[model samples]
Target: MNYKQIVQYGVLIFGAIILIGLVLKGNISHEKFDSEKWKNWTETESELSLRWDMMNSLRNNHELIGKTRTEIIELLGKPDSETKMDFRYYLGMSKHGINTGSLTIKFNENRIVTDFSVWQG
Candidate 1:
């Protein structure tokens, strides 16, 4: 790459790293990951540190068997995006310096959470 192109790429990467840091602050847990914790924190996210803090909140604060979408939103703030039966939250994933992935929450007709999954791209 030319000098200017390299500088531009460097700047973009640095900005991405900073943005990820902001988005992840206090979002994940310091403890080890466990299914019970709703955290699959691993290499996909670069092992930097992210805990699915919102998901953890749902598992801990609400009754997953019956919690409504509105109730969940109240705790996690607005979702990054949503669709007919799915809501998405982005935690800024980065593996080997490339960021991708998001958390997807699926709901039943009653708007109650059936389960959630991670989308690693």
Candidate 2:
């Protein structure tokens, strides 16, 4: 093959590698929400088994935006941390392996969930 053809093939290969890496890093698992598994996860297991998959399902399948704080706790168990207006559930490490993740649910004066977010640190 000519030099130009060889360079083109090299670029294509590199692009494919990058695409695959991105797909894997994104943690494309779509596991359904399992309360048992979620509540059972300990800190040590949390680092190795990320929960983004189940988190995705929990966010999508559950209508938590308007639920009361008590209702959320009934569904998701106790929070790892909490304040007067919010509850934060430790969701384990991120798939990227660099940051820990948590789900923060914010409540309003009436103790109802106003908004929720998934965050990493």
Strongest candidate by lDDT: 2
> What tens digits encode model 1's per-residue C-alpha lDDT throughout 1-121?
8999999999999999999998776445444334433333343434443544344554565565456898667644567799879788775543424546677778999899888776666
| Deviation (Å) of 61 in candidate 2 | 0.6
The TM-score measured for candidate 1 stands at: 0.48
- The stretch of ten residues in a row with the least summed lDDT in candidate 1 is 32-41
Best prediction by TM-score? 2
Error of 1 at 2 (Å): 64
**lDDT of each model, Cα atoms only?**
0.63, 0.83
Q: Candidate 2: deviation at residue 116, Å?
A: 0.3
- What's each prediction's TM-score? 0.48, 0.74
* Model 2 steric clash total: 0
